[model samples]
Target: MPPPNALQLLQSIFGYEQFRGRQADIVSHVANGGDALVLMPTGGGKSLCYQIPALMRDGCAVVVSPLIALMQDQVEGLHQLGIDAAFLNSTQTLDETRDVERRFMSGSLKLLYVAPERLLTPRFMGLMESGPVSLFAIDEAHCVSQWGHDFRPEYIGLSVLHERFPTVPRIALTATADALTRAEIVKRLALENAAEFVSSFDRPNIRYRIVEKDNARKQLLDFIEREHDGDVGIVYCLSRKRVEDTAQFLCDNGITALPYHAGLSSDVRARNQTRFLREDGIVMVATIAFGMGIDKPDVRFVAHIDLPKSLEGYYQETGRAGRDGLPSNAWLAYGLNDVMQLKEMIENGQAPEAQKQVERQKLSAMLGLAETVACRRQTILAYFGETSAPCGNCDNCLSPPKTWDATEAARKALSCVFRTGQRFGAGHIIDVLLGKRTDKVEMHLHDQVSTFGIGKDMPEAAWRSVLRQLLAGGYLQTEPEFGGLQLTDLARPLLRGELSVQLRGLPEKKRERAERGQKRSAASLDIAPADDALWQALRSKRRALADAQAVPAYLIFSDATLKAMLDAKPATLAEMAHISGVGAQKLERYGLEFLDVLHAS
Candidate 1:
């Protein structure tokens, strides 16, 4: 039943025993010059949606990717499968780019990777005219939608590919896209006629957990100390400052940590990034700036110290974990401030009110996912408009969450917010709950309120839970400038006793969870540790180097590089220079220090 050339190329290059899922059908449709819109999850082999078609077609397929590193990885992956491929980016040298262009001019190149901006160039347009573009693969095609999580101004230029080359088969691919984004991708790419394929969004291998925000630093430490110790992963923070501080604190506490962000020079970003990719047992702390195009396969876990911009953003960032098909953890902690911060940002941005409102709704849904008692996998999948039964793999399914009766506690917590005119934070509210009469509470005469001492039966911990649930439920909204709470229309109903508020089930102590032990093992170190202590010494050296440079530690060689060095035990700077990320500049600058550390250890 397989069509001409489709069956041949699939086995020749992919070597798969059989096409997984609807891959064969999609490939067959596109091989016949049909357009495609694919929604496969990470590691679902989405690349084949366009790859097989490129192999069977007449001219080179142009793959538009957002990240330079990702383009390299995809091109490398294609070449590993014995397919001829090349990428054009800032990383490629003049001669290298010229040579790749040489292949394209000869009609010998099967695939070419290009950034959206580069593809829209007059020079690139002329190149397209010279050689036929049999297929166009738009990777992360959601970026073209202004409403999508990772919008790029460059992607708006992609509309031209179809406008100019009306006959070339185009396949737009993304790991995550909601219904709105899906529609936008179609309109933006002019793929209205494109065949649609949406794979299940369920990441069955990941367990999702959201803890209440109090003692967040301690709680995070406690969780990682027990379950994810010495694992190479990513910790996401809300701000550049937090990213830097958390990375430093983790280093001080005996964990190998590095900071990454856009503020740092690109050289440092690339150096740290290379370490993360090529090294093992290294943890990188970053803001939203870090996840796109990251290709590390065994990221054991992803922890967020603050909320993301949207559920789509959160899912894509967390998807970076468990890409190697192993069990991994996705943990986060947030409270009322995260809500106010997100809301305030939207309210203050320049976009149309409709876009801001849409963003707000998306963020609220994400908060619901964090607080919901339903299966995390089901909740996340539903957000993407895909329905699934309980996965029995996430924290929710394994725990089968149980709720508590907090009716009296809810009223008291609301009472404090109501009496104080919603003008204080959690600490002040906690004081009134236990009748502590703290300086701020007494200063405001909140100690005399009848709500005071009424909440004594409930532990301060329980009051904290009640307040978070109420905020997430929309019963309360934080006033950013006033730095306090204000009752929403939702709260008036609850306050007048017109509505009864029900709280979701709470998480157990981190250790009580079934996945309490580490999901990562040493074999994940693709480069076996010739010397275990070498990584530790390399980290120590990185800290000193970062301090001396007044840059984030990751600006030095990353945990990935140190691991790669340890694995290969390269004895010279020349060999280290051959690594993917290190260039002549870094090899000359930091190479000796790392080599000395490796040798000394």
Candidate 2:
């Protein structure tokens, strides 16, 4: 009998009937010993491009990954398909590693996931030389780019795969990479000759929402209680202490939450991550250190309490939500303080001037995205070099933000910064602008300055809005030493009355938005009230099976798969096999159990 083709294997093993986008072409090219560099968005089926090829090719395909948790998760999910997949990481004992090595040497393993650090080791290289290797898959290929947000030093050494295994066809894949990062990945990985596939970076399932920070923690709580109360989500904070405090706050407010950050013990981090993956309705509060390679499919939201460092980081993080292509949210509460803190962090860091310049540019782009009154999705896609029509899914598109002509207010704000010797922060500048006679004002004698108290008509909040827009629009910058507001060269035109400014107005009361959010909550799941009971029953079955197998619930079957089952209402094992995710292996393992539930319901 002939070897199974990609489509056959995809159906029989993975249970998907069709390849998405360029997956089929990529798989065919890689299977035929051609190199490929694939840039697909997260949840875009990038895995099948290499995974199906791995099965069709001659020997075990070696996948180089950065995170051990990612390797473990993928390997476990592959095992559910009855594929002989294993990972070698620090978490394994010597004997366990030896066993996996033996399996690889015997050509019994279809895919072997190894960290770049381990894969580059002399011992592992020797083992690879002794075995018949199929292909090389460098996942998260953008990490090789020094300019990328999630740079891994070890990934820089991955070019050795091409140098050493000259004949082995290799594939590099990433979910997020702009043109510069893409070029860097090609250069660093020696993949210049590889066939490149660039997919659209739009995630239509995610509703992008950015709110001005006002009692941010309370706003976050309100968002959760109103729109996502029993949902699994990830909340990102900029500080470890904030992660801990936010997790505790959520728990105190009756949400199931956990904290994950570098400060946590290894065991604690692992346990929390495991819980997050295996259980439902877990809100993981974490810093940027927490979520690089998480593969959970049912995360309904990704909330950021503070601004991310760059637009690339924001895109990658927000892409984590709605992985199953369901309606989800990418919500952020941004404020002027976030801008100051991030600016100070960049300027005060030990990085080279060139790198700091790049960081500044990236931060400015992120701020523009946050402060944009146009379609948020369009702005994001444009940043990645893709033109998109205004997606009516973002908050700005759904409910347009109000803007005001702030040219005069901006000039006043800039004048205050200048009059204060450009050495005062936003607070002192605002104080001086509001004509407040506090001790600092008396001590500095700013009350005597020409610009001090020049305009008490504008509220303090409005002054904050003007200053923030000034900074975001390159009219002002912060000093590295003391975070004092200073004028950038771009401020010249605006300060000289040569340029006008229109700033986003303070958001009105959120009651109407809250009502829309409630509607969105209902739409996110979209199961009819009559089908809700059966949906819960199917989820319970999946949970039970996952707990028994000690793997994530999604590994058993994704929420998408369960929803398919609920819709199809398959009656028998044979009928259950017809469901989208019910591959041959899963049919044999779980078809009858799910069929039983469906029949009972």
Candidate 3:
């Protein structure tokens, strides 16, 4: 077996003649006998850091991935590229694993993707020792840091790759990493001499927007109607219940939506994800659990109904959109409570003080991003030690937010907290502000407080903005366990009239990109081509087939099928296979019928 030229491999496998950003340079560095640490954003083509070198170098390259399914998907995708790539993990049966090892021994395998746990096993290690190794690749290398979102114990053991194959150049890659996580990857991987390539973290394709979460579902509906316009997107919720409820709500509102989380059965998760990839205009309402290796490139938007734990997590989740190098959106719906709830959870956890402090700093940076009045892209880039000017595309840039004097409002809110004993949440406190005769306020005599009815001039939403800004700006803290608003030492200065506060008003949630005269790309959100006839036909066919099989419509031809039919204008059964959703069994069952109806209409 002979190795392919790097340029040919890149063109044949990835469908690109030239590399993006630092990809070619990173590839050359690894091919020229150098170890590398690549900090590329999601969709930055980090896979090619070692993939190209693996094809050009002699022997095999092993990619140590954190997720088993991610490993499997990479291998399968490589196979799609007509390359010899295999994975070894718990998914493989004893016989299958042995057969893969046989291929490895024969030098027929150019690339092997393995879960860290499986790769470190005695049997796997012994087999690897018998074969010649060219390079070692680590994916999600941030997991080596305890502070990362998806930390795995097995990642720490990956250092053994250096001890076992000391001569092999290793490349570590991650989509999200701060100074702390970056240091951890270098130290844990023992890549003291690795060439570090930190690409620009700014995702210029994604327009970032944050809206306050009052009547969250309504806000989400308005956002979806304006931005979505029948496109594929992901909605990230904090809870499984929210995931299910939001998915159902979207479906009820005439959306082809589905839910994904750890709560669903593995079979159901795989089926839903498969549908998302194949279908156009499919909306996946999922917890953080769903998206890791989902390769869908045309996601028009990534919306979050709750605050993410960290900026890295937020960036990775939002990066899921616009991977195809097209303009997309990152819409976030959250409030002061979302910020506090997350901070409270971590503050109460029994982790190491240093680790908790580091995570808190990361969360704080994310909070700053949410509250930033400058370009959203600049805020995200600054977090990664990258310099960026205002992108002039985000909600802030389009509207040019104006700040207001929040000193009086801040003082009143702080005074209300002090008078109410700091036991109540934001709602009850808001109730007190409007002089509402709510029983809870009367029961606590909160109506008697001077601060009550003092905020009558400002709208409740404005007061909420002030409170959120105060908390975000570190003037207050929420008890990590109790999660009640509490005045911080910093609040004392404002409350005592010693300091005035300033705040940027919340953006009008009702106003979308189009409403503000900020035109979206002509091809808004890699979307399903407009052909209602084909869509209705494919859907009808799917429903009828699903009824006959007594399975979900997704189990039949996915939403992807109709979109593909509309896109490719498939005229025959042979062309149906070109659509991702119509598998062999499905093609045999419904292919002819689809083409006949498509042609007749």
Candidate 4:
């Protein structure tokens, strides 16, 4: 037969029926000696774009990955497909490195994954000079941009690839990047001439929800108990201390939770990550330090006890869940504290004024997202410059938020901030607005002010909501020095009687939203009870097989595939081959075993 083409290799080795979205075009471009910059979402099969091209091209593809764990995972996955793959990282012994180096130089390996740090080493560059490189695949290419959430200085040195291997095709790929970050990646990586492939940023399988923070831990527990029990998920915290405490609390509540952060020993973090990937139903409680380039595909949900720093970070983190295309959740509990803390970080950090301004803008966008009552999906997509209609599955669309004419309330709050010399934060401003004769108010002698008691009619929460909306709506701004509120120029129009503000009211009662969430979560996550036993049996078999092979279970077959097996009731090898993930190699390896299980069922 003619040398196997990209499509032939894709079906024979990877087992997917067809390319998704721009995969084919991307694979063809790179295989034909063209450079590319691919911006696809997580779980969008970015690996196939390069892997297929590598097999179709002349030599081993040098995949510059960031994480050692990710490199090992990808190598193992390719090995499972019976493809020649290996990774060279710190985790490898000198002998192991030598072996992979030998394989690469001999052209026996189709793909070689190396960390960016390692790839930049003179030693590794010398190795690359010794052989023909089919292409250079830079995964998480957004990390090259300082503006990206996960910036790495090592990624900046990657431009050397273009300088040295000028003739070799190059592909830079990232799951998350806004317009600014995209341009930065192109400039930084010297990919000005690469073909650009931007896929849809939407992840419709995820049900997005943002709730106001109130007893956030209790609310998180309720969500866990109701919807995500016995399922793998991630609970993101804003601080290392919170990660530790939350993981302990979950464990105390009889949930399997692990803490991951930069503070932990590398050994502990690695063990936890290995367990999370290899086992099912592990809830990883971590700060922003975790969940980059993770390959697990069955994570049922991603919950945030604290607000994420940016929309890009939020999207990338939550994209970790429901990678198998099953219904999953992107849930968050945000409040004014999250806003204040994030703003304080941005302002107080040592970054230059322009970078800080960009960060503040990003955070402001995130706050608007938190406070938005419209479709959460629409807001996120719009931030990415993609327009989308309301997705009825989100919290806002499912249970619409209440709104009130807060124009007068907003004016009162703004007047309070101004009359207080704009030096007071929301709490004192609320106290002043509510006419509370506290020591601070009395000390400041603010009871004599014109706007002091003008807003006593509204409840304290409602007043806080109004102030929050004022801040979120740009009618008010925060002074980072004292965490106080000030009026922005946008407030000028409102103060001048040229504008009116209408704010979203509180969501439905906690009990009501929780009840509705319970129904929705059940419908989203649960399989048919009649097939539950078979599903469990198949999972157990997968787990057993994974343990024997010492690989993650999902690499054997995702939960979605097992669930499909339960539903399809495939009875023979040929029938098993018809499943979505069962490529020829996989079917030849595990098809008979799964068919036997189905027959037993």
Candidate 5:
């Protein structure tokens, strides 16, 4: 018999009837021995672009990944599909690694995952030479770019795959990259001639919301209680202490939360991560160190209490939510302190001056996204060089923010900065603006300046908003030494009456209440009231099975797959085979168990 084609293999092995967006084209290209550089969004079926091709081709495909947990998860999922896959990482002992190597040499495995660090070792290179390697897949390909959010020094050496095996088809894939990073990836990966497939960077299912931080912890609690109670989510904090504190705060408030960070013991981190993946409704509050290769599909929300340093980092982190294409939220609460803290970190870092400039630019872009009054989706897409219509799903579109002509206020703010000799920070400047006779004002003698008490008309919050926008708009900059606010050349125009400013007004209380009313929790969005019991039953069975196997519940079947079963109500094993995620292997393993639940219901 002839080998199965891409579409046939997709259905029989992966159980998806059709390819999404550009998967078919990519699969055919790579299967025919063409190099490809694919830029796709998270949860956009990027795996199938190479997985199907690996099965279609002649020999084992070598996958270079950065994270060991990611490799283990993917290999486990593949094993459930009856595919011969394995990984060689530090977690494996000598015997286990040798077993995988033996399988690779014998051509019994279809795909072998190894970290970039190990893939470049001389021994591993000789092992590759002894086998009929079909292709090379570099996952998280953006790490090759120095400017990328997750820069892995080892990824830069992956270009040797092309140099050594010029005839082998190589594919590089990443979920987030701007034009500059894309160019750098091409240059660093030696994929100049590879076929580039860039998908739309829009995740319409995620409703973006950014609010000015007012009691950030309280705001986070309110958000969870109001829209996402009993849901699985990820909360990101910039510091390990904050991660621990926030997780405890949520737990104290009756939420099931766990803390994960680099500071935790390796055993503790691994245990927390395993619980997060295997259990339901677990909120993992972590630092950036925790989320690179998490494959959970039912994450309903991603919250950020502290501001991310760059828009790329923010996008990649938020993309973790709604992997099943369900309604989710990317909620952020940021304030002036976040901005100052991030700025100070960047300035005080040991990076070179040129790199520091790039960091500053990226931070400015992130601030723009947070402070913009336009559709958040549109702004994000535009940053990625893709034009999109207003999605009408983000906070700005749902309740357009009020903007006021702060031209006079901006000039006054700038004058205060200049009059203070550009030696004071926002707090002192604000104190001077409000005419507060604080000790700092008395020490600085700022109470004698002409602009000291001229801004008492506006509230302190409004004045802070103006300064933040000015910093975001390039009218003001922070000094690297003292983090003091200083007027920029752009401020000359505003100070000279050549430019006008319109700052976002404070969020209205009525609008906030209305937005809350409009948003339905993840529980109420897709499942009907009548099917809630059945849905819970199906999920419970999945959880029990996953627990038995010591794998993530989604590995057994994704939430999307479970929902499909709920909708189809398949009553027999044969009918269960027709479900989207139920391939032949899964039908044999899990079909009857699920059918029993459906029949009982």
Candidate 6:
């Protein structure tokens, strides 16, 4: 069989017709003993770059994944494809671990998934010495960088893989990495000479929307009721308590919602996560702890109740939705409070001053995106060093917001901060500006200050907006000790009337167009309405098979494959082999049954 080339293995085993983007080049490069560092987006078929190489190589490929759940999921998916895969992690018993080790030594498995901590152990190192290892695949390679959002200390020790087995090819893959993180990955992974494959970071299918937070819970409810009813989505909150509260709120209002956070019991979290992945129309309300290894392809929306800490975190979190290449949404509600809270956290954290500075810059970029009146998609991609035309699907492109020359207003807000002795936070400052002669203001004698009541022309929200923009734009700074707002060096220009500031006004709520290319009509996909029953029956059958095997339904056949089968209406097993995702093994195993369903329909 000429040793089964990369494309051939991709089609015959994985059942995909062709490699996506640079997947073929990556597979062949690694298969031929070339190192690679791949910076591809989520849902960009990153797994195939290494999975195909694992099949084409001589020995089992070892994948270092961060989470045990991720390993189990990938192993189950591989098993359904009739591939021999296994993992060694704490979840397995001692005997089970030893058995996987034996299989790896004997070359019985094509791929072996391990955690970084376990892979660096003495026992595993000994097993590596006894085997003819194929290559090393470092998944989520961004974890190696200290500056990355999901940094793991254990990942720092993985560079020994290259030091020990210099001949074995290594491939590092990450879904999100800025310029700094990419350089750090190359240095830490010892892949300085590896072929760098940087794919497009744009997820055009996701319509980005950032709304001003007002009656936040009501606003979230309105968004869900309007666009994402009865669809699978993820709502991200900043804290565990918020996750629980949001989940309860959603369930109370008749939405199927579940909470996932580090505070929950392991059993409860696992159960909730399993229910979310296996079932349909489940909205997982989670903190940042969740969604790292989730492979669900049908998430319709990702909503943020509060602002994320950085652009990288925001990008990664929002990337979880629309993995099926369908039109989805990334909606966020942020306001001055979000900025204040995040600044407080970062300022008080124990990280070194240098790291804090970097975080401030990243947060500032994220805030800029939130306040941008231009295309949200362009702003996101520009942050990642990619350029794109304005995507008309985003909120700003669909309905642009108005901007006002708030230079005078900004000066007034900064003066309020300065005149208040730089001791009071934004709330008190806003009160003084709005001419509120409250007890706190009177007690502090802020009402008697020259800046007090001078800003009565602008509304309270508008003033807050101006203050937040000043902070984000580096014209003001927050004191973590007392949550006080102070002027920064950058504010000198604006304070001295040397620089002008412009603030974006909140956009009026507009009727959003129906999400484009979200759901393909049966007729459009070549499946007649009369055949809908049969198509659903096929899905039901696949689900039953998956449940019987205790695996994800996608492992049996992805939604794309089922759609292809529905559209093609193959009459026999031989004809089914021509489907995009139908490999020889799948065709032989269940193709006849699918053909039978089509014939009956």
Best by lDDT: 5
User: Model 6 lDDT vs. the true structure?
Assistant: 0.86
Better of 1 and 2 by lDDT: 2
Which pairs of residues clash in candidate 6, taking residues 3 or more apart in a chain or in different chains?
none
Using all chains and alpha carbons, the TM-scores for the candidates as numbered come to: 0.83, 0.98, 0.85, 0.97, 0.98, 0.94
Compose the digit string of candidate 1's lDDT tens values, residues 481-524: 65576778877666677657668655666645444643334113
What are the Cα lDDT values of the candidates? 0.77, 0.90, 0.79, 0.88, 0.91, 0.86
What digit string (tens of lDDT, one per residue) describes model 2 on residues 1-601? 6557999999889898898899999999999999999999988988889999899988899998888877888999999999999999998999999999999999999999999999999999999999979999999898998899999999999989889999999999999998889999999999989999998899999989998888888889988888888999999999999999999999999999999999999899989998998899999999988878788999999999999999999999999998998888999998889999999999999999999998999999999999999999999999999999999778888778889988888888898899889998999999998899999998999999988897798988888888888899888999989899999998878889998988898877784466465546543778989999999999999999999988899999988899999988987887777788789999999998988899898
Model 4 misplaced regions, further than 4 Å: 514-523
Better of 2 and 4 by TM-score: 2
Provide the clashing-pair count of each candidate structure. Answer: 3, 0, 3, 0, 0, 0
The better-scoring model by lDDT among 1 and 3 is 3
Candidate 5 lDDT over 75-139, as tens digits, reads 99999999999999999999999999999999999999999999999999999988979999999
lDDT of 6 by residue, 76-185 (tens): 87776788999989888889988998899889999999999999998888889789789999999999999999999999999999888999999999999999999999
Please identify which of the two predictions, 3 or 4, would achieve the higher lDDT against the true structure: 4
RMSD of each: 8.2, 1.3, 5.7, 1.6, 1.3, 2.8
Residue 422 accuracy (lDDT) in model 5: 94
The lDDT-based order of candidates, best leading, equals: 5, 2, 4, 6, 3, 1
User: By TM-score, how accurate is candidate 5?
Assistant: 0.98
The reply for model 5, stretches above 4 Å from the true place, is 521-524
Q: Kindly list the per-residue Cα lDDT of model 3 for residues 255-327, writing each as its tens digit.
A: 8899999999988987787677655689999998878766666687899999998899999999998776677
